[model samples]
Target: MSRHIAGDMQRYNVRPNCISPFAWSRMVGAIPTDTPEQQARVEKLKKLGTKQIAPLASDAAADVTAQIFAVHGNEIFLMGQSRPIRGMHTSAGWTLETIAGRVLPAMKQNLYPLESSNIVFS
Candidate 1:
């Protein structure tokens, strides 16, 4: 969405970017901490304040557009764009068995972990 908006608004000199902020706020304070892992995550989140997000949203970011900036505490990350990392081709095409045996293994290393956002990012 940010990319699309940035592209469309480029003619007007509008730069649109997205900010995915992980800060300790009222909404985050309400997260359930029933589990040990959840409690640990909450503890980590407590260190990141809402003020940390202000810098990225300010005029300092005027030069960038069509980008996702993940702001956690004082850290800023330029998130990856949508692009293919790996591909495989077969002249004879593929059957289920061949895909399972060949393609899955070939792509397994590049596949993202099956974990929640907090677990993966934290």
Candidate 2:
């Protein structure tokens, strides 16, 4: 979306960017952790999330645009756009059963951990 907007507005020199912030706002405070391990993880995350997000004005002033930025505490992390990490191709187009039983299992190492589905609000 940011790239599209920046491209469309390039003639006007308007810049657009995306912010992915890790902050301990009320929403983070509201997260419920069930186990000690989960709680510990949450607490550690809280440290990284302790600072408030910086305003986009500074980023604009710095002339940074059309990029994804991860704000962690006082740090400003400029990230490249997302791209595919890996791909798998089969001569026979995959069927539901094959994908579920073979392809997905092969990709298990790349999957993110999902300890508690209830932790995420959406």
Candidate 3:
């Protein structure tokens, strides 16, 4: 989306960029909890949320327009960068059986966190 916008608006001298913001909001109230322990954990999380502040619209817009600002490109401020952690290679080539038996096991130890989970929110 940011790239598309940047390309489309380039002719007009509009520098469209993207920023992944870490913010705290009333959305925390929507977390569902059943038991007292669960409710307490939710409350704790909600309290922690207060430390994260959302970007101000006027400030963010101005900073992005300035180009001298840090988040001028597709930048993430509070988060870390994506890096390749592990991989597996085979000189003899691989079949489904080999992938399931050999490569999978070899790569399993270096798999990304939550690689086994099926929880894909996107």
**TM-scores, in order shown?**
0.64, 0.53, 0.39
lDDT of 3 by residue, 62-115 (tens): 434322222212333432434567767889898999999987887888866764
Residue 12 displacement (Å), model 3: 9.5
| Superposition error at 62 for model 1 (Å) | 1.1
lDDT of 3 at 46: 48
- The per-prediction CA RMSD against the true structure, in angstroms, equals 4.5, 6.2, 8.9
lDDT (Cα, tens digit) per residue for candidate 1, span 27-73: 88898999999999889888888786776667776777888878887
Error of 1 at 55 (Å): 2.2
Writing each residue's lDDT as its tens digit, candidate 2 over 19-110 gives 87766667777777898976975685677653445566465345656878667667777777866666788899989999998879888888
* lDDT measured at residue 118 in model 3 versus the true structure, 0 to 100: 14
* Whole-model lDDT per candidate: 0.83, 0.69, 0.49
Runs off by more than 4 Å, candidate 2: 45-52, 59-62, 84-122
Top candidate when judged by TM-score against the true structure: 1
Model 1 stretches astray by more than 4 angstroms: 83-113
RMSD of 3: 8.9
